[model samples]
Target: MTKTARQLQEEGLLYDVFEQELTDIKDRTYGLVSELSRASYFDTEYVMSLVRKIVAKIGQDSYIVPPFRCDYGDHVFIGNNTYINYNCCFLDSAKVTIGDYVYMGPNCNIFTPCHPIHHELRKEKVTEYALPVTVGSHSWIGGDVVITPGVTIGENCVIGAGSVVTKDIPDNSIAVGNPCKVIRQVNDKDREYINSLILDDETKNSKYKQEHGYVYSAKDEAIFNIVKDTVHYVEILNKLSNSEIQRRRDFLRTFVAKLDEGAMINSPFYMEFANHLEMGVNSFINYDCIMLNNAMVKLGDNVLVGPKVSFYTAMHPIDAKQREQWLVYAKPITVEDNVWIGGSATILGGVTIGKNAIVGAGAVVTKDVEPNTIVVGNPARVLRKITAEDSKKYQEELAKQKDINKSEFDKMMAGQWYNAMDYSMLKLRQENNKKTEAYSRITINTLSYKDRMAKAIVKEFGENANIIPPFTCDYGCNVKVGNNTVINHSGVFLDTNEINIGKHALIGPKSGLYGAIHPFDVEARNEGIEKAKTINIGDGAWLGGKVTVVPGVSIGKHSVIGAGSVVTKDIPDDVVAVGNPCRVIRKITEDDKINPIRKK
Candidate 1:
């Protein structure tokens, strides 16, 4: 008999299934990569082994392979022979699963999990959450792509590179752009033609059939069954009764405990902290990198992060209208595999950069970026298409530079380097000092009432979590949040009645989440006689900096709210919403296509 939830909880065995799968994937990927590099050409067994590892990593099998770069020995899973080409990333925070025969090009990333949005809490040392990523079978991920947390990529699709996938991708057809979209269908002829290229010979055809468990000529249910039984990780819940604050604290502590082991960073520059780095095989993080990485950050294989790159998955809010409010928010940033991020770039809050996409220099990306395209400028726009020419030229340039600059680079890196664990120890000491300093209970008067409110606000946040001030609300009882969610210092969350927020939702600095509002009528507004309802912020929703979510609004599951926008209405599930009054600018694309719409 299957184990009960109670039994699983008692043993802490709920995540055990995922842990085993992850281990298997790590072993397989390590073995396969070692073998394939030695083969004269594409070794079918080696490739199959790699594919099996990805499948096992994700808890599912039967994935298709795109013509792509396959590397690493970590938690990675791909469905049966999914077509993946040069430059793809599966930076498995927890685990990454891809469905059958998915197609992809250069510079693609699947980034899962991020950090909190408050520097104070980060500096104090706290644990954050990680969300899983899934790509369905037969999906085509284009070049220059990025896939963010808890995102689902659907089947039989085409995604242009240089597009950022921030939410779930649906099945079928073609999608492209900074935010990928389904533009057309992948008709029967297209499939046939593509298959013909692989199935030209009987020997190759037989191998494909045996490995995939079916002939290519017809779709088979047995193959589908094997594909369906993949593993997945679900967040387990403890039944103990406790205040919201205590629960948050416990969760953070537990999550941190799991991450304490395994120092995962390697760099060629001045390292502030090295112990917190989590990297995949064939992944290279360049010089002059600074990360508080206190809240979990991740990277995938073949990922090229440029010099002087600042990854701040932490922030704080401070303002009178919104101080120490609890509404379940945190901003985490993710960069997918095979992605090329330019020098001096800042990727902010719960942003997911798709695979094979190029982020231009000095760009301040305040929102999610798409795959397979070139993005430049402030707030980053899709500037041009990334073709084969671009890929070849860049590779040649990289190789030539590696040859010319290797010895000098090695000599430079030989001194004063740091690892990922140093950051963890530093954070631990800093937080300990803060606790020692707080023995006398320093109180801020003149804002005495606000202090009480701040206490109530703190009740909704996790320990070592920061709450920005300058906001007011009707009642505090109705607001609640999960662990490790941060509310910036100045942001306002007016919880007049009930407001429920899930774990690891990124809410930016200076943003406002007003849970109660009056009708436009003056008398009703003035009398405080307005009807009140609840606002629900789901798990993993990323609200950008300075964005405002109006009263009675329910931001749906895993949606991305762009920065500086006024959200005047309701937003549905799995989308990237931005602009004034917050229109549904685009449904989160699944195919990871970049530059879908030509700017011209």
Candidate 2:
């Protein structure tokens, strides 16, 4: 009979089963470790000779660790000074690399091979290869860690308990838990002291300790303590030697050379950039892989780009209309260094991606990306903070793969195959080709504010750029606008400068504008306030149908006025301005929208 949950819990059956199995595995793992440790130098040499032979067959740094086994070894590389503790397994049909001085705790598994998830194909064993997994040098992976395929863990990092490493981990960090996040940074203090001992030729650690005072602050002290405790706790691991330069050369020659050049491309690789192009680097007209210029991008490298994954400097726009603009403007975006583009991202034109910022993918960047931030989603929203440590880690991890032996690995990877012929060619040969077409309209419009203004009934409004109709403001270089605005009927707005509009504005249609407002003090205005106060628009403003707004007024973020109301005042947000002076009536509120009569 199937066991009931209650019965199983009361009898401790589940725990017993797990414990027994776990104990068995532990015992086996412990035995292996003891055997390796107790062996004499000659015996160790013999075991390694056998190990080398097996590794040659299964690939370098390959060992079975007793309880853990796999189907293939062609795609695995383990580095030196590493250990894989009890209950560790690897499904490495895909390439997997573990670097030097690394440790893996109990029950850790690295899965790199992939298969179709569809149930219909479950009976058929169909599979696809993915990118390799790389664990960089001097890393400590805690118990129950699951390293997925295509992940690269940077050097000198500490992964916390029960963590599932999904994305890439940068170097010199203390990261923890599922979807692992970097919580702290590694400093050079420890390394400096360690190196000093060698320089001083001190045999005893006590002498070295005596000479160095505790200069670290409280926070650093805490971090030091944690790292100290974790040092010996590391046990499980897999290892390999550094890849020779020839190998790296071979891989680059084969892989990078095959990449298509020019304005169109379709590859999936990441490119590291030189120091100079950080502020911005123009695209080579293709979107195959990422061009990483972390150092310069951090400082503000200007990168010019073309379409399709073309622009990625900042987060998506917040304004509804502006957000929609991304479909068209999400091209040729620019950014300064220290900027991060999240996965599957998009950015729009004529916008600057601020320094030290992150833009999450699938986001539609419409506005400027702020510096030193973390933004996410469709219209990217800022969620938290960022620091230089993130940048440091990125640099370290990127450098780890620098020494991979590409040539030898590649010779084994090559194969001959041909893809299916183009459908168009096939159809033509079969005399089966057919074509269909469709049509659509493209609309455009322009309006002049001043021309419309002469015909309006009411007058005596500020002659500022903000007076232009809402839609008409699109083309005006100098047109100033107000905050919380509702505009109607297209109008042309001419903007020079010093055009200021108030908040909570409402404007009307077909208004013609000549907003070259001069300073009230004639002589001073003649020189043209070279750096005049930009047109200011206050908040919570409303404009009447067919009304116009003049620039050079401060507008608040929230406020409302009447429709068809010609505004001249520097109206503030949340006030009810109307008529010529746009006299304040009553304050607007959510309750007013719900119950107008009651508010009145």
Candidate 3:
């Protein structure tokens, strides 16, 4: 008896994706998904009913946010108390099993189909395979994560944000990055951390001490009740449509201590103490902002707080014993008038930003920022003082930039389609090739000469950074390697555009980073139209032998890409990812630490 396409797929054999049976199932699933998407998010009972009709099994208290997509609804199984956030996609060609008490953040994707590598075979609708994906009980998957086919995430695991999970993750692990690896185990420290947030009665009385730079407990009954109420209020505010502006304002006025006239905060804002937050007139707080305002957090007039900015006024004791005792403290955070806090910046407790200050993206502010200055990087060092000349320079540049036509090179640099075979581009590539070829010709034994030639080949070559003599790149000038980075033998960096490698990186032998991307359309390809995207390898990343990173992919800090992996997307920091089409297996953890080997 011959097996059907569905049967073949389930049996881990190659099958056609466009089989009549699969297409019919998918069409049904799409109808249900469309219905689910159209339904109101507030209609909980109706939403759950639709979800039940869609999935194979939905345990008690399981909820899926609207706008969810999946190939076959019957192949998806979700356990009890599982809360899946918005815009999640599950390509359940095979079984997709999600365990109980699992929390999946927004925009998570799970793929169960593997298409043929050969484009001709794929075009012919042959050699597609499906595999199961399972998430164990009590696991948390962060936003924008992708879990590939045949992957099993063990119980009590924490998969961090923006991870591409391609392999099995072990139980009780905390993993993060592109190809996620275990960074640590879920242990007593985690439990203690949670416990330390809960305060006893005696510690609660020390609230006055918090204002005076002394330790206090925030777990007071009144505070807990306030936080709970705030959570409920925020949830409602977040759910409300943008059209209900007046209603949102009214709710905010009632919930927050002082929300001045003309001040606005975008939806999806989170706060522990809403009553402790004060916004001045005309101040604007962007989306996904978080304020743990145990103490007062005040933003002055005309302040611009970017998206994902966090103002933290809480602190725990440094000593483990003291921390375990639940001793915590709070200090006020103040943003003066005309301050601009960039996206993803964290403002720590007891910090003040002087007027007209600018905090750069991803900066960690620990101390006060000086007035009229631009601060950037970790620990928020002052990049430069704001000068009158700066305004003039930018204004003049803006005037000159208006309605200007960009060249092919400029378009290419901006990640737009361009003529790749232009004369200037060809000349640049030819010159780069000469330098690379010259560097390759030098012997490894001639250390000084080789090092000098290596520097001549690339732009911005950092101190102690080394690329073996046999390494190659299309445009050496587009490559910028940081201090202490090493590119092993036979490495290929097709740096059509910028390829920035962070410090302490290890690019294994035969590894390739391809920045160039040709158009998918045959006509565009024939016309020599192409574009290039930047590839970034973050600090301390290790790519094993024969790993291939495609255009626009960023391997995050301290990440490990396994051998023979092909990275197609961004990998977050601190993970171990492996497989063909690399995915995070687990995260790098403290347990992975080993003592330095001694000489025999």
Candidate 4:
């Protein structure tokens, strides 16, 4: 007869149970994790209730921050007055018991399940066993420490930051380093002063927390502002005509600490603290990498962080009371030389991925990865070592694909419709969006300011041609203006297709010129498929306010289009047109002939 999971567990014997049964309970814990991760920082009481529903036992006074994760919440127990910081992962396949008055710092990890050393057995998933972990009262586990299965930390012990404890530590001991060992023992005299200190003494002093660099320091504020500006600035640079390398360098100088020449990050990169970010020579980052570089995000030479790879550094306290005021701390993230991080991978705080390490796509890394290793999956584990031959193969594959990327980029610029999902095309679109945002932010009150803005985006910005304030367009580069053209304020130039304006043209306020036509079918619209046709306006043409010119439509030279007109078809030269689905009401009258439209 088969023994039940409870029976095997009681006997301390290895056993295999259906993974689906265990997963059902774990799924419920994930629901709670999601709620806590997204809950408002001020909802302290609500967050505590959610925690109580998960853990088998927790002290009444203790609280933890959001974004805490556990495999089986009921196996974990906490004592009174304990504090935990943000983004902690507790893999409690077995019991984890914490004593009272303990402090576990940010990004800490506690694991209690290990696979068999025999590869064949591990692959079969034949056996599983868990060992419980214990920490005595009044102990402090520093930031980024990792405690392996069954490690018993004794009373009044201090585990230094970044230590990996694989063995038990005795009472009154201070331990530090990988495969942690006891450093020194604290005697009764030391315990006297330590016990006298209270956690509230430093935290309750609001003025001290604000003034000192304890939270959101003065330097941090400065770095944040510069990061905001540069974040937008880099997007514009990415859209430049391939000759504006100097402008990119000038923008990079504003923030980016310790950057070497020849390094480039694709547009739409994200970061909050630029002063702590470092990049070495020739490192190229693809689009949309988020680096929360508060402590420091350091990248070594020849690193290639692919699109959507994110680096995190910020963390909040576990105690809901401390988290309520938005209290937080940070740790550094380091990526060494020749590392290739795959697309959509996330490297968290206090992680140092060593040189030549390759993180697989969509992996979520939590711990330090050794040099020349390949890791993949959630809570990423080492898959294999990367040999020198593997690096050569990777280079060859990328070299083969470089031509394909350049082909897509060229097709978009050549007026041919292409797939927007293509990497190079999206990069170009985001680049254009960035420039448009910057142009819109400026107050274009005068012709000089308008010219300054136009020069940045418009390819054929003619002499003395001015578009009034609040002009918007899909692609400014597609619009061309002849000499002495005046576009009035609040005009919408949908320039997905070519918009060619002759000399001495007058575009009235609140006018719209649309060139792109979308399909009526729902699937086509949802897929974002569209076609654009050119719009041409003749010399000395006058367009009145609230006029709408559809795609493939033209107004003849010296023609007059009246207010509230919708031009669906071409109008002949020297005619006056008005009204919906506009047609020529009459030939140019004496009044129209006498007052030809002139540049404002």
Candidate 5:
């Protein structure tokens, strides 16, 4: 008796991916995913209701952010109180189970499908197999992580950002890096460190106990009232539209201790103890940022806090007995002037990030960071120190700007603030839109027509450069594609500034290159003022599917960016990088030439 494709898949055997049974399931899941994506962002209750129809089982209080993608949604199960953040993809060809209290950061991909290593076998029939992936309870899976087939993460583990989990992780371990390895085990020292931040009796008596690193009762009458009042203000702030800039500012000033001039916090912000927070001049907090500011949380001048960045000032006793007793402590967090904290990065209590420091996306900073340093990883480590050369190089680049009477477009190209709503800029975009629309209308079968349309759209189109249909870009004339380059489907290039792609580049599907930036000042932003920075992709580079490259970034020659990575910093030549704030895992070597299939 012959077995069905679904039966073969369930048995963990290779099966035809395009089998009618499998395709039908995938088609159904895609429709549901699209419906969920279309749901209003603020409608949490409605979103959860739709989620129940998609996944096999989602326990109480398990919420998944919108714009999520998955294959075979019926095979996925999530436990209670689990929070899955934005743009997460779970390719659950087999069962994918997530345990309770798991926090999965943005752009994380859980892949269960495995294809044949041999190219011949893959091309012949499109056959593949799948294995289950399980993430344990009370674990933190950092943003942009890729969990490969058949992996099991044990309970209370911390899987760091940009890590590729190729194997099982032990319980209570802290693991990081590509092909992730356990760095340390969660021990009593972890709890002791938080406890050590508690103030002495003398200090606690003089200062506000909650703000001075003293353990305080969360349920205390005074503290509860403060929280209650703050919640009222926060809800109003979250509900306010982007156009209500002045109103939002007014509300913030009334509740927050110090709301300095030019400081802007985007809507959907969450905070506890609003009066304990302080913002310096020109500090910008992006959307969905959360501040558990039980203690004082301060941001110095010119700080750029990215989306989903969290400042955690509240902590509970590590001992189960004490935790049950509702014993909690709070510690202050400070970010000095000119700091840039990337998206999804978490700043723990008692951490003071010094001036001019960069906290990479998805980084979990636990300790104080020194000035002029760049940090990344789960337990964030100093990646490099900022040098004079960095300043010099940027100055040199800026000097190349032509000194003629500059228009708004000229200012935009020079990375200076300019009016994006200017008549000339609007005309250019309208023309560019027409070209893009025409290009999109042309079918793939007409290769010559498509090629001509692409050439007309970009500034310089090199020989043999191919871009699939459904391509999107803000301004096409600022883009330059090099020889023999291939950009896959659904590519979005926001070319408000220059986007230079070098020769022999492979850009995967659903990738985005964003070069636009808005002013930190709320007034300027509301006035339609904007700026842009150049994005450069070097020769022989490869960007994986769903990769997002932010403004002013450069991908060096012969480098490979893994799938689902959010690149926030420059990647040097000849390396493999991955994660939210993408970090280099290792340098490419000649030994990489050896293929396992050939060896077999």
Candidate 6:
């Protein structure tokens, strides 16, 4: 007969089991914590009440951000004025004691349970044991840091970003890196240096430099000049009139640190500092991509980046107050040769995407991706290695495209589509759409408000460029509709990836332009992951009512899509495409343009 949980705990046994029959207290408590994790980040009192119910003891004035979790909260203890950041997880299978004035950064994990290594020992009626984890008072744990079981972090410690602590740490030390080690002790000399850096400001009674220790005077000549030049480039692209391809390319190349021969960046790209941004030969950067390069970001030769992809090298303090003070740091990001990053993928700081790796769309990559591997979903996991089967399809479909190399990672980079539904992505879209939905409710009849709404998407609305109200998008900032473009009412333009509409383009009412899509597999779809591709509608293009254009599609210059057509494939220039899976019906001729006639 199986022993009761209390009896098993008294004997020190395993508990992270899936099929085990937990008691009502455990069931309800775990369920309650799940609900609390889904609660609003702003609901401090409510979440704190729930936190108190779960933890063994929590001290006064200690605040934990919502969406925190533990296996058994009853084994956890927290001290006074301790603050935990977003999405922190603790496995309180054994005791977890966090002392006073502690700071925990976002995405930090403190696990106290170890699984059995022996296969036979994991069978029914198996025994288990867990080690405890402790963090002494007045310490700071950086983002993405992980502390393993049986680790006791000392008081007044500073654990650096991405550090993994597997052993005990002494007090008043700075610990960092995988298998963390102390670098130095905090001393008064550090305080003296910090005091000297502080700037004085006038107040009624006294002068003070800052509200937090993290704040410092941020000044960089390179970054300052880069920002100004980049802004000017964006303005030029938004109002670009002449279609001199070479001139356009030349203008765009000046925005980045390096743009090799045959490299192409679809217009309306965004970056914090262009000086640190470098692109190798024949690399393809699709529309509406955002690169926050506080540190160097380099993409190797033949790299293909899909739409709305983002690389962030900037990060802030774990302490909320410190973040408010705008104290920040950054790490560089590098993409090796022949890599392809799908649309809507977000690569985090200090991550190096290996050569020929394919990062699936909508993946929130927090770690380095291995070379020649395909990774998908939140905290992206490797799906499989690039095989011959994948390469065969690549040769068949996009053979005509230049720089379509068969390097290990680039073959069919966009072929594998998986579903990844993330909480953070969902939350962001929800917040963004809320604002767009409000704009949708505004009176479409008014020209001024309509113009104001159009400004949300287009930087410079050209001669008669306008959008009828009832518009919806993930973010308006990525889109730039060109001159004489008329987007009809109730248009759902999913601008998660950049949507570029050229001059004289006519979009019928209720047409949906989707730049990103989720995995089709039921399980993957449930994961809320996505793959994005840019949708480009060239000049003189026309779309009928209720047309839907899927991701990574391009409607060629002066092409026409019939009513209610679903465009899954790219249509060539000056063609008439129509159908559920829209196909070309006929080519546009001079006879068809001046006067209407049936092609016989």
Index of the highest-TM-score prediction? 5
Displacement of residue 9 (Cα, Å) in model 2 is: 44
TM-score of 1: 0.31
Displacement of residue 331 (Cα, Å) in model 5 is 3.7
Worst 10 residues of 2 by lDDT: 433-442
- For candidate 4, lDDT tens digit of each residue in 314-405? 55443333333335556688899777776546677789999877776545677999998888654578999867565465445434544454
lDDT by residue for model 2 over 273-359, one digit each (tens)? 221122222112212123321112222332222112323221222122222222111123446653545322444444567765665
Candidate 1's residue-wise lDDT over 454-503, tens digit each?
55543375432334332323234455765555554334454444677766
Clashes of each: 121, 103, 16, 3, 1, 10
**TM-score against native, each model:** 0.31, 0.26, 0.48, 0.42, 0.64, 0.43
In terms of lDDT, the poorest run of 10 residues in model 6 is 204-213
Residue 409 alpha-carbon offset, candidate 5, angstroms: 2.3
Off by over 4 Å in 4: 17-20, 187-600
Top candidate when judged by lDDT against the true structure: 5
- Give the worst 10-residue stretch by lDDT in candidate 3: 591-600
For model 6, residues 248-346, the per-residue Cα lDDT tens digits are: 568777677898886766543556566777889777775446665667789988777765466767654433344334345566898998777765466
lDDT of 3 by residue, 167-257 (tens): 8999888886545677887777765664554455454355455555566655556656676687667766766643345677777899898
Candidate 4 to truth, TM? 0.42
The local lDDT score (0 to 100) that residue 485 gets in candidate 1 is: 58
lDDT per residue as tens, model 5, 1-600: 999989978877778777899988976776677677556545689888889988999998788977577868999999987888665778788899999877786657887876543323333354667889999888888665778778999988887665778799999898986558999987887667656755666634322677656766666777877876886687677656534556878878988999898787875567768888999987888655677688899999878886656777766654333443345677789999878886657788889999888887657788999998989866689999877776665455545756646898989888876777688886787677667756644442344588889998999999878886546676798999998777865476879899999887778655778787754333444455667999999887878665778889999987888765778899998788887568898887765444322332
Tell me how far candidate 3 lies from the true structure as C-alpha RMSD in angstroms. Answer: 17.8
Q: Please report the TM-score between candidate 6 and the true structure.
A: 0.43
